[model samples]
Target: MDTIASLFSFITWPVSWVIVQFHKLYGAIFGPDTGWAWGLSIVSLVVLIRICLIPLFVKQIKATRNMQALQPKMKAIQERYKSDKQRQSEEMMKLYKETGTNPLSSCLPILAQSPFFFALYHVLSKIASGDKIGALNQQLVDSAREAHIFGAPIAAKFMDTPEKVEALNASLTDVRIVTAVMIVLMSASQFFTQRQLMMKNVDLTVKTPYMQQQKMLMYIFPVIFAVMGINFPVGVLVYWLTTNVWTMGQQMYVINQNPTPGSKAQDAYLQRLLKSVTQHGEVRGRGRKRVVKDIVAKGSDRNENERRFFAGLAKAGFAAQADGTVVKSDTVSAEAEGGAGTRRQQPKRQTKAQRQAAAAQQAKEAEDATLSVEATPEDKPAPSLEKGPKPQAKGAKPGAQDAADKPARPSRANSGGARQGKSGQRKGPQRPKHPSSKK
Candidate 1:
């Protein structure tokens, strides 16, 4: 353990150096006598570490995707070498090598920071026990020893000292309370951050042993941390809690903006995009290289409502064309016009009552037209069945007719004198023929 501690102290010199810088900066600002300075220095250390590890975080994401992509290959190898454990292991390693993937890359960030974590823990433990240790001289150690955050010593542990045991036996002391609260928070944050990745970001369709292990570790790590937290100094607990908070927030942002294609987070992102399109006539991706649009603007004739809506979309990083198409703000105008062409206008927004009322009005008009067609003869006009051929209505187009003005046919009984025979002879005025023969 001593040899390990020596190695960690050397390996994590940069981290310790950063911590000392923050400690001094905060101490100068808030007085070296206050615990807030020391406690917040630990927080600042976490922030610095996380900022430096961003590239590693991005690498971890790429590695996760690479691992997911290799699932099929891994499964095939497993099936091929099911009878031979050594062969399966060798083949899996070969596959990982070929794909430029590291199975352990997911844990790289934490593993890289482990030495720093332990180094800080050792430094604080020594400072709490009145021993001057690595990078921290006697004067800094004296200040650290005096640093009490919320009445709990910065380096105090739950079961560390005789006074702490007596305080536990007696009543609630600031040391126990602070330690317990920090441990709970740290454990909870770790658990939820891991849980969010598994539930929202993971592609459930690609179920593999690696992901299964992750799921198991999600629960396992929290329990382990909770059990182990009792032995960790309060300063170490603060560091871990701050780190967990940073990870959670970073993960949330990644999930919200650039989630895996088939994950629940992606679905949620799409839903948010659709809502934006509906409300503001456009949607834009946040901090994303590629932007997807669900709506377009057409024509410059926008009213106050549309102008306001589009202005919001523009502020959110959507660009509008002169022809009314909206695309990603980062896209060049030539590309936008080429790809995101003019789209059909969205249907006018209407309330449910308005639609219902319009439908009802149409139905009523149709019913009235049917009733008019079914009118009784008593309601008919006199000219509708007149003997004379009616002239077309003035200014009416050819073939146009009005029901009330249409000409009617002559009655058969009143046209007997002009009857024609089937032999093609017209019998005009048949009474004259009868007078010439024998009436």
Candidate 2:
């Protein structure tokens, strides 16, 4: 545990040293014998740090834009292999490689600054508690002690009053009011600055899940900072507020001048600012009116009028239903030919054989209906027609009845006559069947 602690301290020590040195340097340069001087010095330091990080910030912005622009392609890839997890992963990696942009690029700046932020917090806490005055260099500590502006001490403890040092402690009501206000402003500025960046500068193409996660952090981090702000010294709040302002200004400058294409703010700005510029420069006020006239000339208004007429008809219940189902008409002729209760009329040239077969089927159905009517109440359970032939009547003879019960045959006389006629029509002379009969 000690080893781990040592490792952490090793990493944090330089950050802490840098923060302390920066504070002392600002105090010396601005002669922080006044609160305003120290406040301005903190602002200067923030500006200097931000200016130095400008290049990295630009790179991060470009990377973020590139990531956003890739969203459509990424979505396409995801949709294409929605069912293939392995393939989706491989394709996503390949896409990242090709684009030379990481989704993590958006977080790089915050991650880089986290250590410095921690160090700044620690240094502020020390100053606020008044426990590290001797630890600070003699000259810097003395200057910080002397710092006062607007009758408020810069290095005063949370409950310390200017009157106490000036021999008027009994007369002063409160001295921490300025500190509390500065702390609130610090947290508020941070919140609004981050909120503006997300609302205005963030690229629209960033995935919704990612944007939602970022929004969660945006609120969560500010709340955490606000809670922590109470324990921090007024000097720390000054630094934080200055930093937030610098960030806001820097972001505004970048968005106004070099905004990423398709970003929310960029789109809005172009629509409001660039549209008017181009119109005035190129079209001389006639462009917009001419465009509107052309749109009117294209028959859109006529189409809309037609749609309104149809809509009115529908509202009055006169619209036709075109949903693929056949609607039957109430009038006899208007009724569809094959609708229920309507028989289709067949063409009248069917062959005799077809007519006979249809007549037999009808006759069989009539006989079945007659039999069903004649059946006794005791014979309620009828056998399926599909099973086999029905049982014979009790009084019926076996072979003779079977013979009689068979389906009726066509008349032999008519069949023989037809055969004889067909034979007579053959184009050849008939021959005797036997030699003996011929003799």
Per-residue lDDT over 122-176 for candidate 1, one digit per residue giving the tens place of the 0 to 100 score: 7776776677765677888888888887778877787766665343232236778
Best by lDDT: 1
Question: Each candidate's lDDT (Cα)?
Answer: 0.75, 0.57
Return the TM-score for each candidate structure: 0.62, 0.50
Misplaced by over 4 Å in model 2 are: 1-32, 71-92, 122-136, 149-176, 202-207, 271-439
Candidate 1, which segments miss by more than 4 Å at Cα? 1-4, 164-172, 275-439
TM for candidate 1 is 0.62
Lowest summed lDDT over 10 consecutive residues: which window, candidate 2?
Answer: 319-328
